[model samples]
Target: MSPQGHPWQKQPDWRILDTQFGSGNTFLATWLTWLEDADHPRLLHYVAVCQQPCSASELIKHFEAHPKLASLALELSHHWFGLLPGFHRFLLEQGQVVLTLCVGEPLPMLRAQQFEADAIELTLPHTCQDELSWFLKAIAHCCRRGTRLVMRHADAAETPGWPRVLTQCGFTLEPMKSDGDDSYRQKPSSFSGYFDPAWTLQRTRPTTKTGPLPVLRCAVIGAGLAGAAVATSLARRGWQVTVLDQAETPAAGASGLPVGLVLPHVSSDDCTLSRLSRAGVRMMLQQVSELLNVNRDWAPSGVFERQIGGTPKLPLTWSSEGTQWSANGHPDGDVALGSGLWHPKGAWIKPAALVKAWLNQPGITFLGNAAVTDVRRQGPTWVLSNNSSEMLCEAECVVFANANGAFELLQKMKHSALDTQAQESHLPSKQGMLGLLSWALHAEPEEARFAPFPVNGAGSIVSCVPTENGLTWFMGSSYQPDAQLERSDQENHLRNLEHLKELLPSLAQKLAPVFEAGTLHAWKGTRCITADRLPVVGPLDATDQPSLWICAGMGSRGLSFSVLCAELLVARMGAEPWPIEAKLARSLEALRA
Candidate 1:
């Protein structure tokens, strides 16, 4: 179906076919209809014959200008622009809806293709021309025995007695609804063609169970952002949840950082990670802000990323406009704002505070210092233990939220096959060091607010955040080997100062004396990454083990990807629609299991 409206508008259970796609109106209407109805269709095949195929760029620009159709039009234009001819499919609503876009001459394409569709839409011109007859014939051949065709007549004279034509083609018409005045009288017809009465007409009855449903008790091994989010989601859905953390408090790992950046880590053509990160950021900001009153420390400050060392221009946001700007700039572009990129949406959050908020709710149990060194299943329940042979927790479902620690646990389970295939190393220069920097001259308190910078610099990301001691200037986000975790603070601080000088020379010059005097304090945290540089969030496999899940490898975009990953796991557990496309969800799942 043409994506004129939202694809989830009407849900169906069979394939869908579309012949004409002018402005994708009928296609979008059907898509939106399918989206609204949960059981609309299992598969949707959209075919359009465009003799004059408009450039995706031009179509998007046109859609942006319209009022009523602007939103839906922009969405469709994005999908179209992202399309590459040949059968391309997208999994929506957790594989419930599969969208197949076929760009070519619809009549010939339909004739060559053989798929049973529950619905078909034709947006033909007013006259019953030869082309229309050919298109109708092709559509008839493609429609299965029970297919429903929704055709829109351009004019009254063009309404070529479809009832008779359909009857001749072995289709029985069932008039549904009509819109328009007597003079215009444009009517819509629904027909069940050559359908199996047993399959289409039969009412489904619920299966009678012989036993009671099993109780679902889930445990999350980390209480950081990802674990907290996942546990909260499961708890909200009526699952008994227990959150375990080795630290005294949650978010004490890499997530313990005072502040973290929240923005879509986008790419040129919207890869799986880029798309999920974009959607994840949006969903996180919306849900987090609503669930907790922690907005004070979490303000949406836009991220300013610049290409270093003559790298190709990076997109400022994850939108078609951002991609165009980056592509058009070629080797060098000052910078461009993304289409859906909102600075307010990509805010800074106190990680620990957020995690604590998630644990404060009912139905969630927080257990600190309850490290699990081993996991074994006892029938349907999973049991965890510590090094001292003490029982940690028991549950039907278990999720691993520890970053690098996840690998160790999986290895212990003899399921080392679940190891992340690739790992990334950030050049130490890219790491940031945060500290408190006293102004050369003490000014009014209002001047202490954090100021946005156009490029990476030595200035603290959370300069505005004040503590009883003084204004905090966080720096030294430099990348170091995970093994360097034991390195001294002084060494890391000097490295961070060097990087600071590169980003802002003036700041280095002004702080030279302070640096020499060791007046600058520093902390270091290594950003964990996968070989593919994407997060791993979903089920884990263990030989004869009870339910096991994992939510890790968030890297530096934790604030942006964490909450959404939690939502994905929750949806998977509840068998509900995923917040992201199905392909993306699978892409983030741990590969081995």
Candidate 2:
């Protein structure tokens, strides 16, 4: 089938065999076709002969060159990179479509593999005209009665040869009308390729499964950035969600910071964490903009990443080709600074405002000061309890969204073992403090938005963000094991001022006139961390206990990972296809479960 044809046009259990795979175009086209069809094939076994397997790096380069195919190509490239030798399989749509890639000589490999196909597609390479007879013979040997073989013959003379070969093999040839026009036949060189047919045929057998569909209703225990996002997604997918928080208002935890920054978690190469974060950041910004008007409460100001002298340890490695830098001259001749893609789409969002927007949706319910004291399964439904020793709520599914609270609950349930044994540890801890300062800036809010700063300095890193109240300067976002939430206005002001002085010595020297007379307001909150330093978002099953779900431990990148994690959880509920990929959705699930 061509890229334009639908793979679901055929029978559900029909096996497809392809002779030639170039640039993986046919495979991609087939995958797209399957996505569009309602009753997709049960199994898709793609057998193609490739002289050389495309390297992971080269696949990425090709995707970069072709902007139109970038999204699909990049996803395929990621899968290709993860492939191992021998038979490799990927389950799509809950195992309805199984893509099996055979990476060797097609004719010999097909003979050795114990599988029969309902249809065979033979793509003759542009350079293999002399070997066409042998290829056709091999294909004929593989086909049985009722098998449909679609062969691509470029020249008119080869059409006669094809029919003759089919007759010799005790098969009948049907001369269907060609798809192209007279002009297409007149200008052979101008034709893009051969005809691609979309036909339907019955499968020889049906594929069967042993288990029933997993149905669940979940709860997210926090209404902060991570919890609110997760709840919104679950509710959108028809899951009953009740958001519980000890605070009077949503986003009263670390997400209480007046303005949270949105930046990708940088890492070397395209590892699982790096890829998930990159995609998560883009998805978060897009969802925020769509749910809440952008540039009003949420606006993405380009981030300025600077290194004054030594090489800095970046969360993600710099992609030399992917980065976008300013052409203007640098302020300091001694510094060699460069800027990469920070998501022109990335933005600073008012966490509280965003949470309220998500909860405003119909299916979501918010319960404040619920303070969950216990969570355990009561029959098939999970029950929640408060300090009063009374049942707070019950649902078929449950999610632990309160960061520290979730950790404590897991410990009590003895389900902590499931998380500790995973590849990416999910143990929680207190890591940092985000302090917000109310400052009177000399410059306009727009001008202050893009001001450059030293993010990795010895003192607290500060940045100016525009809010309805006024221009707010954020500083003293320190990481420590024992830092507590400090609400004292005077102490916060003095700490921010001292930290600002250490960051910009020249400005501090000239700021005596402004600092001595300037008024300030400040507040502090603690950030939660995970053992592997990545957010935990998915289903959990404790030893000898009923299943529980989680969506927490987002750390500083809560704004970046929250929405994506939510969408992932929603898709797991099996309501509909999410905007993100299936593999990524499963990646976020609790691996041990």
Candidate 3:
């Protein structure tokens, strides 16, 4: 698309859909163009579909001749790993430029996405000619009126019927000047068009536009991971966000955990939760890279998980991309080697740091100790009140992200449509406070035997995190449901020691003396977990004009799921493309049956 005639020239954000990402040259060029433009759109989203994506070296090699684009290509290559068959979102230019790589078959991948493309660049390999009609039909499903389309092929004579296919797909072709130079690429034959159908076009769901959805007042209850994430996501979209919390400081809840593992959950079937965790970890890592202090607040040092009886197994669909994300066995040079999985993309993040960073974003105001006890609709605004019926804040939108507190608040809103659904779904019985106990030692029992990275399985151990008492090694985090809760610190330490023994027998023996001495520091927190084990996300009240939302029930995967769920929530509100696939997003729906 030329600058003069670009449809998204004056729009808040522009979205383009690329059918195949052969070398990523088009994406690089588009990004460069956006960067050079003095008045570029607020956001530039380039969604591309790839089948069996190349390695980072291969991607970087393609730009060897294009000196101007080489640095951009290198930046893109760094986050190009884990290109499994799913939607992989890359946040470039500090989240301004979004590159969503849909890795799979073109038609199926296009169906999985839900954004309205401002421009379309179609270039299919010769092998895809048979499915060209189907591909165009799927592409049309994501187009809006006046959506510009361009088709390029090596030889137009080979595919004379493509024009007919475009017509059937509801794309009206535009006349092109002979031998016109395509700004992005100059192919032998090129056809330009816009989406304009004659008859009523049917679709499973409406396409969503990239957004700067009218900035309004938004009150996010809970200054923890979920709330802070939502606040940041909304604030980035220009919303005035007020983060209200019961505690005196941000992340003064379960999110107050000093350090937590951000790793993917592996299952044989690559179940919904597993897929969701992978997406979440990817998003969380990107956020950490942009917002937190690496090696201090967080570290992408990787995690080794011992499977105890059996070796850690990846899903049957695991491929090279899976290896980049997680391997079946640990890497070399590990003191605590065993039959476990190595998650190279895994990390340990101090949730409070991330929460603080998110809350500190522009347009976001953090108000602690607000303790929103009741929520109700007043005309078009959502009114949040405290325990004494005193108003906390009134905003155009409200999101409950206080974990178990969300259920209690929702229960108080008797007339809420979502409240009825929550009650019928047995949300209370489906959720509970799960107390966890972790202990840290001022010194390592055996420094030489300590693994450099975190190890998890029966329980978890993170060695050598800086604390007020100096360097410390954290372990255990013994899981104790409310019923089996132990109030004594010694009992918790014993339980944590038991977990260490199960996870690493040899190391446990060395640390047994420390546990016996009761000199280890204890850290305790209660996490909210749901029966299905997935976080609740999406609109809680009216779906048509939703004003109330809930993003909670993160369990122990708060670091893994918070950013993803926050993006999903704000994406729905702004009508932007969902970060994950529609089916995967549905699993975390707040009002699911």
Q: Runs in model 1 with CA error above 4 Å?
A: 1-215, 268-272, 292-295, 315-345, 414-450, 453-460, 466-470, 542-546
- Candidate 2 has what TM-score? 0.58
- The digit string of per-residue lDDT tens for model 1 on 1-593 reads 32334332444234556655555555544555556555444434354444334566665555454444455555545434333222333333333333444445555455544344556665554446555566666666555566665655534466666555555555565544543211211234332334322333221221110111233788888877778888877765567899998887888777777766666554555567656665666556655565545535565554444333443234445444344222322122223311122232346666767788788877899999888888776766778889897888898888888777765666566323333222111211122212222222223453332235223323333444444455455655656555444555666566666765655556556555656666665554556677667777765532323267788877777787887788677655543334554445657866432
Error of 3 at 252 (Å): 0.5
Q: Would you list the C-alpha lDDT of every candidate in the order shown?
A: 0.55, 0.54, 0.80
Cα deviation at 30, candidate 3, in Å, is: 1.4
TM-score of each: 0.60, 0.58, 0.93
lDDT of 3 at 427: 46
- The reply for model 3, stretches above 4 Å from the true place, is 1-5, 125-130, 177-189, 204-213, 333-336, 415-429, 444-448, 483-486
* lDDT per residue as tens, model 2, 1-593: 32245433544355566665556555555565566566655444455545446765675665564454455567555445322222334333323343445445655544333344556666554434335455565555445456665555445453445444445544454544445322211122211212122333232321110111144566678889888887766654445678888888888887777766675544434456655665566556555655776655676664433433432234353433223211122334323234222333335677878888887775788888888887766776767888787887887767788776676666666232234334234444434434444355445523322245323233333355556665555555544443555445555555555655554544544543444554544446666676566676655643323346677777777887887777555444442223233344445555422
In candidate 1, where is summed lDDT lowest over 10 consecutive residues? 203-212
Worst 10 residues of 3 by lDDT: 180-189
Q: Give the per-residue lDDT of model 3 (tens digit) for 272-320.
A: 9988999989988989998988888888889999887774578877888
Which residue pairs come into collision in candidate 2? 217-397, 266-315, 266-316, 267-315, 267-316, 300-347
Model 2, residue 562: C-alpha shift (Å)? 1.0
